[model samples]
Target: MGVSKLDILYRRLLLTKLFIRGWGRPEDLKRLFEFRKMIGNRERCQNLVSSDYPVHIDKIEEQSDCKILDGHFVSPMAHYVPDIMPIESVIARFQFIVPKEWNSK
Candidate 1:
């Protein structure tokens, strides 16, 4: 099945939270930008991050086969990069938020 709207919102929320927590890199910001473009509604995306939109974390966990730990979603499929690498490089290697289906598209 295709990625659902909830999936997209979950990703947006995760990215926004990451940025707020100072874990975001330039590449992560770019990914958020791409997600905004895909949604075609910048205001809605902003509202989503700003409001409690009920993005079901359990559903996301089951769908993506990922686990949310310490407010960070960890994906087994994501590449492992050393902390010695620059934040940009580490962000580039990790695809933690976006679904694989969207990545293929």
Candidate 2:
């Protein structure tokens, strides 16, 4: 994840952090909340829609880009940070294991 700070994706990631923690300008927050709710609902229904469609599943391990990061956060601070420091910003990244293929250029 060697993304530069000036990159647009990096900015979007910062915006995502703000949106998730319910902090931002009113108009931006409104739009973010709207889209967040829409996407959240769509993700929530994915399992139901998949069951209905009953599409064939692929053996993803055979794919050329199939790399899974198997890991979990030990101490996620985002949940409790807001309560202590209302104005402070928080960005967290955890170490995870990814296939060598993915790490290779």
Worst 10 residues of 2 by lDDT: 74-83
TM-score of each: 0.22, 0.23
| 1-105: candidate 2 lDDT, tens digit per residue | 333566656457656756557665545545544444544676553543333432233222333554433323312223422323233334322334345464556
Best by lDDT: 1
| lDDT against the true structure, each candidate | 0.47, 0.43
Q: Which lDDT tens digits does candidate 1 get at residues 58-99?
A: 333334644432223332112322233455443222223544
Task: Show where candidate 1 strays beyond 4 Å.
Answer: 17-21, 26-105
Best by TM-score: 2
* Local lDDT at 1 for model 2: 32
Segments in model 2 whose C-alpha atoms lie over 4 Å from true places = 1-23, 43-92, 97-105
Counting only residues 3 or more apart in sequence or on different chains, how many pairs clash (N, Cα, C under 3 Å) in candidate 1? 0
